[model samples]
Target chain A: MDNPKHGMTLIVKTITRLTVGLILLFGIYIVSHGHVSPGGGFAGGVIIALSFIHILLAFGKEVALKRISYNVASFFESLGAIMFITLALLGIGSGYFLLNFISKGEPFRLFSSGLIPLYNVAISFKVGAGLFIIFVILVTFRLTKKDDRE
Target chain B: MLELQILLVFMIIGAIVAVKTKDLLSAVIAVGTVGLGLSVAFLILKAPDLAIAQLVVEILVVIILIRATIRKDLPFSTSGRWFFNTFVVFVFLIVFLIFGYICMKDLPKFGEPIMKVAQSFLNNGLKDTGATNLVSSIVLDYRAYDTLGEATILFTAVIGVLAVMRKVGRKK
Candidate 1:
């Protein structure tokens, strides 16, 4: 499969790879240190989505689409929404809307946050899948040959 | 101070590039860069909550722009509507000036009494909420309603995408 063109070159490819790796690592750092630093699930998730966008720009939309199909991405997005809502319901039981760690109070530890970690994971999945789906749809529309249009 | 100046310069460049770019996709990305810069600035100001909100909204806006305009050619040049551009610039300048003044005046001093209050809240409240993460407590307990609203906004965006991108005869 040949790479589709969108001004991608070898330098772009190399930079994209390095950037994606760095973004993923940085995202983990952000989420893990969210309690102490200026980062959390949303920021981490956006960083992760950016990694996918870098891949799309470097490797082409076809490679990205193949790696994660639209259907699967949609499923993950919906699943994340469901999980978030479920957690919110759990909070209602405790007179809150998404409270976690009511039972286990482990402060100053990564695993200490009961639902925080789970929320981060859910958000990451949702953000990644949502972004992938959006990119695929947009790029697919953009890349279709003019002659192929109805 | 130097880092702040550099960040401000980069932010201005990103915003100008986003507004002036001809290519729609590049413009979208330029706008994203602006948002990214603002989020970083938010971190510097110790407003992580606002930063997260900014990032999430930025991503959603980018997605919506892509979905809406991907099929059309992104026109870089308008007929140079001078009056409209001037009006926009004037409004932007006024807003920026006001915000800049407010920020300078109302911002808390670094390492002040408020920091201690904030710290004590995090230190003591973490145990009661079962969340070791101070940010998580801020998000899920102290301000869970805002988080819920944010999630709903995303959900609405998903539904909007479904409505716009749906093909004929596709089952809902």
Candidate 2:
């Protein structure tokens, strides 16, 4: 009996394995430099989520799930939401909702923006995890239904 | 203006092809090409943010559409209903064009913005927010509430999708 792999051909898998890391890194860069650049947490996070999805397409569901399990993804999603809210709430400490409480360093520096970069990070995590969860749910439901039928 | 019109034409062609194409994959590609054309238009309009967002979104949409098609056989609409569908489409198109004409008649022409709120942001966004990037200053500082609302909507959507999928899985 052939225990076949779930995803695409060898070349695709190999390319995915090689490029997924690069994609993830690029997403992080975009998220971090969002203030200075065109891309932001939403865009970067989507790219980050897509990177994981690329793996899922190239390798198999099992392999991709192993890298980032459903529970972990769910946890990050919640955590990101909490962090975003917390950032906003913390602004209240400065006498305004979502105020820039921290000292803003020199412009163009990585740490210049007060709470903005942190918000970007939180948003990136939330968006990335949420998107991955949505994709996983969409893909896995049919498989689970099939199992139930069996 | 010519470049912008060229891009719009490409997008118009792409939209027509996307709808008319029988093959699901080709339709998706056509839609993606439309997205690309729209992004290029955005770039020409000097909205880098919109351009980047559009391009990324278009890619994600194509991926999702491809994934969806992988499971089901996606047949184009048969010629039997084509006449009716085409008629509806044309009616909508005319309605849209008329609405667009009405709106555009009063609207500022391309790149000419009569901005009040935007004027404030443009003038003092840096002085107030201490952020060099005005776009970031506006989004993260000047209008954080709107961003919060948007993020919440996204969260709600993700949760809804997850819940719906799980229910379908359990029922089956």
Candidate 3:
């Protein structure tokens, strides 16, 4: 298991390579179309995080971390929260926090919702990165190797 | 309604199996089955958002639970106090029944929509928020402060996880 060059069996690797991209794309579709669809930021973000976890399970930590490291994920998690708060505070000038200030475009269109798409994007970033971070920490943390940590 | 009742029965059976199973992996999968039934029930009830969310969350939870249990030392020691355990269970059942009785007294009739809020939301949600989905608008626009609070709670939870999982908590 400590080969570090590969992970799992060849069959699992082949299947993961074929399906992981599709899962990520589907998550993006869900987030982008949240205002018109069943899924929104939280659900889409969980799907996105699951995609990364799939890679980790099939290809091991080295490859998965090479794709998106812990530091980068943590950075994006904080950045997402800041972005969401900034969007909310932008509404304060109108006597309300998180007030829909943008022009409500023609309904049912892709870009119709005033600030909903942006909020979805922000929340997706937060949830996806946070969940992935939690999974990585929980999976990688070793009780015996405390002193020789990464 | 028939389908829902069947699904509920399946969920109850799964829960029983989960509690009765000795193998940790089997127990986890049984619990996952219960969640899967719940997700299906949500879909049958016309709650696509909740169904989708529940399904995805159930998948993640099962994976995490399996990871937490597999290859770990098993501790199945019993205290040999069945009488006390039964007494506690009886007390819990009494409290649960009382709460259920109170809730049943206030529950509206089946198929009756709570028109107070739903009517207005359905009538004006699209015009007000310019979104095709009323649920999204309600969650992200009308009740955005609620969403913000939820986001904050998630952020705090992540921060706490990071803090507790840190390799070196003190500057040694």
Candidate 4:
């Protein structure tokens, strides 16, 4: 199979291969530890989305799209929003919206916060996929000249 | 305080560079420098969460802006009316200074709670939400409605962008 030249030079590709997984891992860490740490869902999700964008920037659209298609990203984005709303609605069982119903575990622990970690996860998914798809759409879109349109 | 002042100066300088530069790519980088300085200033102000968010968001913005500048055949020109632009800049600066002074007068002293609500949150946020980080507790548990609205807005924005960018919205 003949492979046409795509993406950046060798150095950028090499650096991207090495760093993308680490960036993704760090983003997950931020999201999971949101309750106990500085970074929460929003920041972590942005980082997660950036990782995918980094892949697209370094490896070109085809390879990046192969890994996570536009449809898959859109699905995850909606799924995240639905999961968050459902979590909020579930709080009604406790007599209030978004009320923490589960037992609050020991403070300062990883699994301590009731519903917070879950919220973080949902938000991360929503933001990450939403931003990724936005970047993909904006970058891949081709604008034809007025002459061509005419 | 001195460090923050220095950072603010650097940010101002970067903003000036961003405005003065003719090349779109250089301007983007200069703006990134300002954002980086602001992020560091956020860290100095002890808002680590904002700092992290600012840093990452700055990186992403720079990346996206650089991509946009590089890939397009943008017919950007900086030879516009200089006197009007300078007048506008001066007007903006004066207004900003007035607002800044007013805000500074009204703001509570640093590290002090200005509102009973803030004090209450500080005192009981951990106990109520079981999250050691007060910001997280408040954002997720206390102000979840706001977050829901924010998520909905993001969803709407994505859908709008998809609709506008799609090659075909309806079948012929």
Q: Which candidate is the best by TM-score?
A: 3
DockQ of each: 0.34, 0.61, 0.80, 0.83
Output the better candidate (1/2) by lDDT: 2
Report the CA-based lDDT of candidate 2 relative to the real structure: 0.83
DockQ of 3: 0.80
Write model 1 residue lDDT over A1-150, tens digit each, in one string: 245465388787777766778877887777666654566777776777676666776787767667666787788888887888898788778776565634554566666656766676677667667766666555555333654474
Which regions in candidate 1 have their CA more than 4 angstroms from the true location?
A1-29, A36-38, A92-97, A143-150, B1-40, B47-123, B130-133, B167-172
List pairs with backbone clashes in candidate 1: A101-B130, B22-B76
* Model 3 pairs whose backbones collide: none
Across A1-150, the per-residue lDDT of candidate 4 in tens digits comes to 012388888888889889999999999999999999899999999999999898898888999999899889989998898899899899898788888899999999999988999999999999999989889988998766653453
State candidate 3's TM-score.
0.93
Give residue A12's lDDT in candidate 2 (0 to 100). Answer: 81
lDDT of 1 at B66: 64
Candidate order, lDDT descending: 3, 4, 2, 1
Chain A TM-score, cand. 4:
0.93
lDDT of 2 by residue, A49-87 (tens): 999988887777888899999999999998998998998
Deviation in angstroms for A128 in model 4? 0.1
- Rank candidates, DockQ, best first: 4, 3, 2, 1
> Model 3, clash count?
0
CAPRI class assigned to model 3 = high
